[model samples]
Target: MIARIAMLFVAAAPLALAACATPAGEYPSLAQREIERVGMVMTPPQTTPAPPPNPTEPVLSQARELVESVRTAHAAFLASESAVRSRVAAARGATAGSDAWALAEVALAGLSTQRSRAMVALADLDRLFIAASTSGESTETIGEARSEAADMVAAEDAVLSELSAQLAS
Candidate 1:
């Protein structure tokens, strides 16, 4: 009876843990979304847009908006991978057959398509930026901005790689 109860507890624990995930992973709060919306557009735009519905908050800075629109959909994928890694580490001693491990695996798989989409977006973004130099901008100015963008891409790639490893394990 004790063995059976232990098995039942093992089986139910992943679900219990999952329930504890309130915000789950890196979902953007409305404010983070707005801040992220603004911080990204350090580059000056070629043209100004028309008036926004809320003068208080432009939907996003156009250049930053463009960058994020390309970059951030990876949140779901990265966040799931992060969650799984944490779960696996937490359940490190469990049997391979345990429900907790299986739950983590399932969550990882659910995020696969989102990962693929994010990769495609990143690739497309890279391609678009290849000739991103504007005539008015000095070469140093364009180079600096591209360097900054490259840094951002590299950081994101590192996160994605860690996530991929967790999923693989």
Candidate 2:
């Protein structure tokens, strides 16, 4: 009985030691290994810094220029409409289908064509303003651009109303 007990104790001792031993290639202490790994990971990377963002002034300037162009086109339309009105007024006392009346009619047709072209220009400017608003522009800059666009549109509406009144008269 004593020999069998001694044999069992010898067998269990080797199994217990094997269970407690660290695996091959593994660190002896888990906490120390984790601390060392975290220290390594905490070091900053060795890459160059990024460049600064581009300036927005140029974008704003371009938007302003586009607004000016729309204003100019609107002014031209107003001038052309005024010219048509003047021609019509001059032909008022003349006979229908007379040379002066015919001339006035031709001038009015030309004004229509000019007005169509100006409208196309204004539409393009509107597109530019929308693009400026959506292109990652600063909010303040976009607000200024929007305000300018609104003022221009109001001016355009006033001019159109005046033109309508002239035609009605």
Query: How does each model score on lDDT?
Result: 0.55, 0.65
Residue-wise lDDT of candidate 1 within 1-169, one digit each (tens)?
9999999999999999998788635765555554367667577669988874642123123334434543565555556656666765655555666887677556655655555655555554444344343323223433443454455556556655665465445
Worst 10 residues of 2 by lDDT: 160-169
Q: In model 1, which regions exceed 4 Å deviation?
A: 1-66, 74-82, 95-97, 131-169
lDDT per residue (tens digit) for residues 1-169 in model 2 = 9999999999899999988987777756454565477556676689988996675776667666766665676567667776777877777767768887777778766756555554554565556556656876565654565566566566655655554444434
Kindly report which residue pairs in candidate 2 clash with one another: none
| TM-score, structure 2 vs. true | 0.44
Give the root-mean-square deviation of each candidate in angstroms.
Answer: 31.3, 13.4
Q: What range of 10 consecutive residues in model 1 has the weakest lDDT sum?
A: 54-63
Candidate 1 yields a Cα-based lDDT of 0.55
Using TM-score as the measure, the top candidate is 2
Q: How much is the lDDT of residue 3 in candidate 2?
A: 100
Which parts of model 2 are misplaced by more than 4 Å? 1-55, 91-102, 109-121, 139-169
